[model samples]
Each structure stands twice: as C-alpha cells, then as structure tokens.
Target: MKQHIYPLRTKKLKGSIILPYFQGINGDRMVVPFIFWALFPLVLLTGCGGNDQKPEAQQGPPPKVKVAYPLRREVSEWDEFTGRIEAVDSVEVRARVSGYLEKINFVAGQKVKKGDLLFLIDPKPFQAQLNLTQAELERTQTKRELAKNDLARAEGLLKAKAISGEEYDSRNKGYREAVAAVRAAEASVYAARLNLQYCEILAPIDGRVGRELITQGNLVNGGGEATLLTTIVSTDPLYVYVDADERSILRYKRQHGPSLEGVEAQLEVADEEGFPHHGRIDYIAPSADPETGTVKLRGVFANADELLSPGFFARMRIRASEPYNALLLPDRALATDQAQRFVWVLNQEDKAEYRRITPGAHVGNLRVIKEGLTGQDRVVIEGLQKIRPGVKVSPEQITVGGEQ
Candidate 1:
C-alpha cells in the first residue's frame, strides 16, 4: 500500500487534510476529490443555515396586551359646576314686642311648623296697657252715648223753636267731637290687643329653627329694632346655587332652545362619588354678572328626607345635551400627546395605530369619544407601555368594564 497526503482547500477547515481511504499509488490528487465528496453535505448545510436564520432574525414575538372594542351607548353630555346648597325659605325669628323673654317654647335645632309658638315675652305689661285702653274706650263710649241723647233733645227743641239754631248747631258739634274721641279710643284698644298678641312670638315659617339668640329672662326689644331670637330655614326642598361662565350659559341656552325649564341636574357632595341627587333647573339669571362674567343658576331638589342642608359644598352637573348614540372607551385606553388627546387603536393587521380623538363628558370609568373613532375599533386598554405605533401586538379581546 502507498501512503498519500493532500491539503483540504475548504474555507470551513483551515490548512488541514485527512485521507482515510488512500490505498493506491500516486493518490494525492484523489485525496482532494475524496475530501470534497465527504464534506459536500456540510457545505450545502452551511449555505442553507444563513437562509434559515433570516426569518427568525427579521421577526419577533408580538407584545402581549389587552384590547377591546369601543363601547357604544346612548350618552348625554353634562356640564359640571361647583355650587352651594341654599334654603328655599329662611327667616330670622325676632321679638315683636318689647319685654323680658319669659319663656322659650321650642327646642333649639328642631323642626317647627308655621304659627308654632316659639317664645314668650313678658305679657304682663302689654296686658296692663290693653286693660287701660279698654277702660278708656268704655268711658268714651259712655260719654258719646250721653252726648247723643243731648243732641237728639237739641234737634227736637230746634224743630219746636224751643232753642236757637246756633245752640242746636253747637250741640251737634259737641256730639261729633264725642264720636271722634270714641273712635280714637277704639283704635287704641285694637292696637293694645295687637301688642299683647305680639308678646307671644310665633314661628313665621315652617322650617328648622337654629340656636336661640335670646334666652329666657333676657330683655328683648320688639316692634322697633326687634331683637333676633333665632333663625329658621325650610328643609323639604333645597336650592343649589351655581354660577356658570357666560360662554357655558349661552351654550346651554342654545342647545336647549332657550328654555331651561325641563333641563335636569344632578348633585354630589364632597364625599360622594357620582351625582346621586337629582333636580331640575328652576332659575337662570337673565343677565350675567359683570365682575365674574358668570350667570347665576339655581336648581331645586326634593329633600324630603332632609339629607341635604343649606351651605353644603356640592358638585353639580346640568344635562345640557340630548341623548345620542356615542362611542365610548375606557379612560385607561386614552393617551395624551401634548395638548392633543389620542388612543392606540388596533388595526386589521393586529398592530397599534395612533388615533387622535375628541373626548366628551366622562361617564363612570368610560369616556365619550365624540369623534375620530367608531364602535368597531379595538383600543388597547392595558400594556400600553409595552407597545407603540406600528408595533405588532398579541391582543386578548376583552369586554368593556369586564374583568381583565
């Protein structure tokens, strides 16, 4: 057997050659052919490996995100405002007659009805005055009766020529003076009676009474610079006063056709979440205020349970727009780019696309999309940070407001 050697000329193997099947004389040239045949498959595979890697290197796993179609529902837009609760009727209870406050007839901070006795000023002085007026009235009546009898006799005497015309005229004049005096006495008596009645201070309105400003045994001047006894405020129906900007007022009037009579309103307190109390717009100021450039508006709410009270800080919303079909998206799906608002919508290729939208009033966790979106558009609600425009996403379809 003759041994032969040859160098492998393949780029994969560097400067090495191995001849395992050299059993002939002068086989150096045969070594090259033999090595090529043995390594041909490997060369072919190396070239194909580049092609196999191209697909994976050019592709990546899609970003996982949660998405859902925009919600479609009938929605009405509301204009929100900050306001305060006011009482429909409020009265300051005052002493009507001057005297010592002898008694307080009502408990403080309690509900009182109209004509309910609230306080008692000392009635003794008023009663004494009444009695003196009554006595004077009786005396005047007696004198007038006597003067009438004298005038009748003088008239009969004048007819019979038993007295002069001047004497008869004088007698009639005396009677007229007596009659005028009696009328004055009667008026005094009536005034005295009215004063006595005023001694018993009564509630002028049905309402909740405040703390007593003048307690029993305190001297209270009445009928002139009357002393304030307490305050009463009606509680059944409450007024919510709000000031709206001039532009907003005009918009509301335009949308509602210049009549706000039936426009509905809702109210929520500081600790409340949504507007739970319902009401109607009862009044809108005809003119806007020059200083604030806002119009005063008031809404009336039924407060039969007395849960609402005057002076409460409240959030109010007026239903200014009519209900219409609207597309809505979760607030989490919304994105803001500078001053413009936008959202990532899933295109047909399952890729994110930036879409600018006009947002309207917020309803719960959803926002009203006034434009730039349809009900069929899939919006990315979660995993927003993991994807951007034109990025492929693995979307998991979710129902709006459903558990993720």
Candidate 2:
C-alpha cells in the first residue's frame, strides 16, 4: 500500500509568488470570463438605481381657483339703448308779412308764452292806408244820406200825383247803390285794420326761441319768400327716439301682447350725472327699419322744469321683456377658442374639468349664463391659463361684487 499527498509550493523571491499549479489547472484561461461575470451585477445595479432617484410626485392639489355661489336676486329687467331727445312741438318761425323790422321784441333763447310779442314791423304804410279807407268810408256815407233824402221827396210827390212812378223808382235805385258803396268802404276799413295788426309778429306757441334770423331795420316784404326768423321748440313735454332690434321687439310682443303703454322707461342725457327724468313708451313703429333691422320707439317725458332740451343725446333704459333668474359668470372666467366659449369647472374631488358654456346677453361686465353650467358649480376665473384637464385643484371661496 502507497500513501499519495498534494503538496502546496510557495516561492517568494522579491514581493510575490506565482503558483504554477493553477496554470496546470487552466486557471489563467478562465480569467477574462470570470472578471466579466463578477463585475456584471455591480454595473447593472449601479446603472439601474431607479427607486433612489425617482422624481418627487406632485403634491396635493394642482391649484386653488376662486369660486362663488349664484343666488337669485330680484333685479329690474332693463334694456339699454342709445337715443336722441326731441321736442314734442317744434316750429320754425318765418316772416310772413314783410316790412322794415321795427323792433325785435323777444330775446333769443327765452321761454315765451303763447301770443307773446316776438317781432315788430314798420307800421307807417299800414297806418296811411287805414286813414285813406276811413276817409273813403265817410265820403260814401254822405252820398248815401243825400240819396235817401231825394228818394223820400220822390215818394211823397208820387203819392200826391205830382211825380211819376218811374221817378220814385230811380231815386230808390240811387239810394240802394249808395248804401252798397258805403258797406264796401266799411269792409275796406276792416281790411286795412287787419293789415296794420299783421305788422306785429307774435309767438304762436309756448316755447323756447332759438337765434333771431332778422335784426332791426332789415327790409321785409308782406307775403315775401319764407324767411327764417327763429325757431320755437315746446319745452313742457319732450320726446325721445330710441331704436330697438326687431327680434327683441317681436319677442316682447309675443310674450306681453302688442301694446307698450304701461311700460316705463328711464331717460338720461349723455352728459348728465344721473337719470333726471322718466317717461312712458308712446309709440312703436309698425315696421322695422330695413337697413338696421330695428324699430323706432318713442317716449314722452314731462319737461316742465326745462332740464331737457331738443337735439340732446340721450340714453334710455327700457323694459323690453320679463325678468327671470339666471346663472351668471364673470367675463374673465370665459375662455374662447375659435368662436366656441368654454370655462374650467371644479369637480367634487377638486380636479379641473373643462365645460363648454352657452353665453347670453352681457349684463355690464358680467355675462349671463344661458346653459351648460349649473349654478352650484365652481368656475375658474384666475390662473386659468396654468390649468389643464384632469389636474387637481383647490377651490378658494370668493365674494363676487356687483352684478356678477
């Protein structure tokens, strides 16, 4: 029997020793593959350090949007319109009987009562004509007296048979002709009197007078060409003309019937500070203005205080339809793409969701919500550009001022 043992050999000359036994086992041939396999897991683990470097998840809600609760309010429904103020009765005072203007009796821009003296024409020529007519009437009266005396004498002689019937008849005819001449002369005197009175021009209406067209000593003719002396505009009652769209008027008519008598309107002048006066709808045009598709509506206002004047620019608030409660949104909350309007609404879990809205009339800076939104929903007004769909949001309650 023989005992066999593997011997471990070590040779160290300077610093290290190489064992030739591993070479005998083909160890060097396995060096490159073994190094790769040893470092492979470390490289993969270092490059794929995913959990440690994961990005921080976005916190809580995306943003806080301002919101409000829409409540029903009793507002007097009104429609605004641009209009013009006019006088109920306006007339141009023109010179009818012409002569040298003797005096301008009324001041310009003064309120005058009816029959107030406005202007005076020279009456010297008219006075002379009146005196001539009077003299002619007197002469004709004297002739008629003499003719009547002769007719009486003829009638007495014919009854005594000293004069023929033909003579009495001739005297009667003479007296009749003389009497007719006197009547004609009297009529001439009346005509002369009227001509003299016509020299004075009077205000035909109670109104305010405009600028004077003729000054003193301006030669004017009786029955001359129509010359503008001044303009008179009645101020007790004023008229306003307003235009309304045809569709709106028709809708109102369909709901409220044809008449607008009881409808009250508030009127204000353009430069005035407040609505100084109110009026009622007096007229609505039977047809619409073809070009504008609007109907002309007129209102009458009592202007006894003389606050309103003719040709003034006016603004009117008219009751065009019935009042109803509606959802309202701030104009800034609205977003538009192409022609479609939209807004971002908050969900129950505080997420941004887009809502398409149907917009109605504009109530001042606010817009009337017609459809596509419930009054309870929260609408995003500020920070809208920073939000998108499915983003979480936090709603901050806000108080809306004014109409919106």
Candidate 3:
C-alpha cells in the first residue's frame, strides 16, 4: 500500500498558512506549524516596542575639580625665629673711692649723659687737705730761694779763697736738698687735687639708670666685691639674638651662599601683634651648636623710640633669598605616603591622574611646587578623598593669588 505526503506553505499577507491534507481533502496540521511560526515573530516585535521594556542607562557629567593659575613672583623671602632683645651698650655705675655718700646728685631711674654728676661725698676733708698741701708748697719754695742765695755767696767766697772749699761744698748740698723738698710738696698738691675730684661721682656713659644700690648717707667701700652703686643700660639701639636650625642654615646657604650680609633680617617685638620694623643681619655663628643642632644669629635694630626694650623677647625674620616663579597650592592638595609626595591632576581626558611633586618652601599658607605640576594643571583641591587613579573627573575653576 502507497502512503500520501502533505505539503506546507506560508503566506506573507496576514501571516496565515494554506496546506493540502490527504492529497485533496484539507488537513490543518501542516498549516498549524506555518501559522505559529509567522505569529511568533510578530509577538517578539510587539514586546520589543512595548512600554514594559526598560530604557537605556543615563550618563551624567564627569566630576569636577578646581583649578588655579600659578603666578611668578619676585619677593623678598625670610626665615623667622624667636629671639631675645638686649642692650647694645650698657654699664654699671660704681664708686671708685671709698667714702660716705653725703648727697645724691640725680633722681633714681633717670637718663644721664657722660660726665654728669651722680653723687657727692663729704668734700670738707678733701678741701682741708688741698689747703694744707698748698701752704706747705709755698713754705718749701721760700726755703729753696733762701738756700739758693746762700749757695751763691758760698761760690763767691770759694772764688775769693776767703772760706775753706769744704764749707762751700756744704752750702751747695743744702741748696740741692731744699729743691728736693719743694718737689715733694708739689707731688702732695697733685695728690690732694685727685682726692678732691674723687669726692664727686660722675656717669661714665649715656644711659638710663637702674635702682640705686646705695642711698644717701650709706657708707660704701672700694674693698667690697659687690660695690654696685647702680646699673645703667643703653636703650637707643638694641640687640636681637635668634637661633636657626641646621636645615634652615643649609637652605639659606644654598640660596644666598655662606655670607649673612646678602641676607636681610627684620624684627618684630614678640609682644606686639603685627608686622615690625625691618632690620639687617648683623652677625651669624661660625659653627652649629652641638646640643641643639642650630646656629646662633644676631640682628641689630635702632630702637629710637625705646619701643624695643632690653631683655625683651622678640621675633627675628631673615630674608634669605629672592622670590621664585612657582605654582602655589594649598597644603591639603598634597598627598603624602612612604613612596612620595603627590597630587591628583585632572587630565583633559577627564581622568584623575596621580602626579608626583617636589615641594619647596612654604610661603604664607600656600606651598610652592617645585616639580610635577604646571600652572595650568587642574589641582584636586576638593573631593580628593573621593578620587582615585584613572577615575573620570570634572574640573571647576578656583581663584588663588601669589604670596604677598
């Protein structure tokens, strides 16, 4: 017995199917597969265009960072240190001759000049000694004149051969003895004058006086080791001694050589709260202190108004070098690790690239960047905590000025 075969066909229109079953009688089995195949593609297309489908992922702008243009400046830079103020010149008033102070010449704590009388001792005794010396000197001169007349007469007698040669020699010796007596009396007069001058005490230098060590009627002696009558200190010009660390000294040497004159210093009274009058570097240590590993430097300032007092604590700032054109950034912009000091730079590709930087001196609150970043680079000042290498970023502009 021969079996019958079924044929299937699909129509593009309406996506329906026509089939022949049992050679002439119609059977739906062949059309069933064709109809389902055409309808399946339509169902898939409707699902693709349906509201139930998800939309595409949305993208926002890249993260932003602030940027500042660096400026080149030529400034007088300085290194600062806490220092102590001292008098440029000072002296202690002392009694040269021992005596009872009968009178005080000036008030205590007053400014005095050279040769000014400071105190007076009892002058009555000195005056009496002077008078006695003068009277004795006159009496010695009268005897010397009389002895010379006797010597002349004795010489004439020797020439006339009227007296013995021995008698004439005796008279010549006596005349010489009288002249020696006159010389002794003149030395006594000099001594008396010196004693009279010692009765008054005078200032040795111009300075402000300190508290009086001895008051009027107080007996002071030269034998006393601590014979301090009073102390005087000069206040017109003052000294400021400052200390600098070894590192700072080395850095300054690299900039200004080993000489300190090329470096200028300014002084600010430590008690005062502001910029101070500028000064010059007066001296620097030849060697470093072993214990503290620092160098001692001193500066001199004109304290004309007495604004800077002796023994006052002050601040000394030394301008060690000239200013440089550099990129200045906030200290927070720098990230440090054991590896190196670096900062995040937002590249044109909107990526945060880590850049290594070599830092320089700190000018005010900003830090100088010696290497690794250009003036045009966008520095990650904010949002640095959130940034990482190769991360996309956006940059926002920031305003920054050079060190004043």
Candidate 4:
C-alpha cells in the first residue's frame, strides 16, 4: 500500500511565503519544500519593515512630582477638639407684665444695648391701678390722722377717769390699724408703678434681638407663664463649649499651671481653613462628667465683626506645648506603611527613598515631624503614588504650604 501525503492547509507568513505543514503520525509525515527555508530570511526582513509597526516609546525622564523642603519655624503644638459656638449671654425675651402688645420699639434682628426699649405693652390699665392705689393711700393717711386725734383725746379722758379704758384702747387700736392700711396701700402703689414701667419692655443685656414672636396687637399673658416675645443673644463676645478628655485637661493644666483661665485658645468654623479666631479659656469644670470621663470647658472669644454666631460648629484648639523650633511637612506628603508613617524623600541622585516618620500634633496643613527627617530632606508632597522605594523622580520644589 502507498503512503498517502495530504496538505492540511496553507498559511501566508510574512509578506509572500505561503507554508503548509503540520505534525502528523510517523507513517503520514510529509516533507516540506526547500523553497520555505530559502525565503524565510527575506520574510523576516519584510515583516520588520512593515509600515503598521510602531516604535517603542523612549523612557521619558521619571514622573514629574512636586517636592518641598521641610518647613522650619518656631511653632507651638496644640490639642484640637470640636464643639459649638454659643452666646455668652442668651436671653429669651418675654413680656413681664400682661397686657395688649401696643408697639414694637425696635426692628427685628437689630443689635440692642442694655436698657434699650424693644417692645411696649398698653399702659392704660397700669396707670389706672396706680391712680386707684394713690387715692387709697391718701384716704388711709387721712384716717390715720383722724385716729391719732381720737386716741389723743381718749388718753386725756382716760387720765381724768371720764371714760372706760376699753374706749381708749379701741382708739389706740384704730390708729395702729390705719397706719398698717397706709403701708399696704403704699406697697400697692409701688407695685402699680412697676407694672406701668414694665409696659415698656427693655433689653436686659446687650445682644442681637430675634424676630418678635407675638406681634403688635396680640394679647401677651405675663401671669403664670410669660409670653415669649423674641430672643436675644450677645454678639460681641462669644463662647465656645467643648468637652475635653481628662488626659488632655491634665496636660493643659500641667503646661499652663493649675489655673487654665487666660490660656490662649484658637477656634475655626467648619468651613474655615485654620484656627483664625483667637480667644482664651475662661472657665474649666471643677468635676469630670461621670459618664464621659471628660470635662467641659468654655472659651471666650471677642467677635467684634459678629461673623461668628451661636450654634455654629467649630473646632477649638488649646496650647498643649510651648513654642519650639521644629521641622514640618505638608500633611499630603505623609503616608502609611502597614503600621508606620512614612514619607518619600529625594536623595542626591533624585531618587525617592522611604523615610519613616514619627509625627506630632498637626499644625494646620503641615504636620510636626518628631522624628526621621532633617531640614535638608526634600519630601515628596505631590504625586505620591508614582514614587517607589528607589524610583528616580523629576521634582518641582515648593514651600510646605505653597500651592502645588
């Protein structure tokens, strides 16, 4: 029997070399033509010179990144806490005397000083009562004078033994009662005058007044529960209340002496960048809260611009350590390596090297580097991920807080 040879298929290789052969059983193996070997070198050259092929990109100078020398400055470390801005003096304006709301003396949301008139209640009723009390007091005084004259006459009669002692004693009792009545009437007159004065509601403290709750022409009840007319909150000087841990409280007290008052504190609102508002702690709690193990502290800040309002979310910082010269880097330059904090620094060869850092309290965007860096180290501030243990980098130098 003849050993049959069959070409399975043909493939066009390179430019024009068509080859057809594939492995088969020993008995069916077929020999390839020598023409394939002769043209293989030419095919290789044609494929290499094809127009569709692209050249490899030349390795550009290592990735460009922003770098900065550690900022060296005299700095004070601070402990940060969050709290709310509050008014030092907050008052719920209420009517003290019950009457018709006759007039509103000041516009809503206006700043009012102590004793500034804010509202007015009808004074007609109070004036009438004052008049009645005055009249009653005059009548009582007249009665006391008449009683005195009667008692004097009775005394003479009693001495002469012209009448019983009972009548003389009765006259004496009447004089004393008249005097008591006058005193009661006078008290009533004084109260009536006070009620009339209350007709003009005045601000008890300097503050910004809120909108009136009960407008003019409304009857305000000042009896059992006074009517809430509006609210007022002191604006110039404000308070920020924060709860500090026992450890922090102790640390602050130890550093600034036992008395924490007058120790400088700084505050910033949620939208602010740094602690721009400056103040001092005015009050410290004598006892710690049993549940939280924290003490409440009150910071007093002058809000002359009235930009800081009560109930605003704020961050408060109190000095924790004295000022000292320290090395600092922008917070963006710091990164974590498993359990340790580290930053990439470019060496003399412009290659990044891992530098482990022991960080201290954060001072705004910059963090205090307690360890692992010198003033000469150029830290990688931007393009952190592109940096490797020893990767070369093209660096652009910038200040710690300068824009990247």
lDDT of 4 by residue, 1-404 (tens): 97845646566789998777654555454557779768989999888987876688988779999998999999998888999999989999888899999999888899999999999999999999999999999999999999999999999999999989999999999999999999999999999999999999999999999998987999998967999999999998999999999999999888877769899999999788778999999999999999999999999999999999999989999998889999998887899989999999999999999999999888877899999999999999999989888889999988887764
lDDT of 1 by residue, 237-295 (tens): 99999999888888888977575776899999888887899999989888889999999
Clashes of each: 0, 5, 5, 0
Ranking by lDDT: 4, 1, 2, 3
TM-score for candidate 2, residues paired by index:
0.71
Name the top lDDT candidate.
Answer: 4
RMSD of 4: 5.9
The C-alpha stretches of model 4 lying farther than 4 A from their native spots are: 1-68, 346-351, 390-403
Pairs that collide, model 4: none
* Model 1 spans with C-alpha error above 4 angstroms: 1-61, 257-259
Go through the candidates in order and give each one's C-alpha lDDT. Answer: 0.87, 0.80, 0.79, 0.91
Error of 3 at 83 (Å): 3.2
Candidate 2: segments with Cα more than 4 A from true spot: 1-64, 75-77, 138-183, 255-259, 272-276, 286-294, 304-307, 402-404
User: What's the lDDT for residue 266 in model 1?
Assistant: 96
TM-score of each: 0.83, 0.71, 0.68, 0.82
Worst 10 residues of 1 by lDDT: 21-30
Residue by residue across 49-125, what tens digits does model 3's lDDT show?
87777778898766666655554555445677998988888887777667788988787888889889987878787
Cα displacement (angstroms), candidate 2, residue 271, comes to 4.0
Global CA lDDT computed for model 1: 0.87
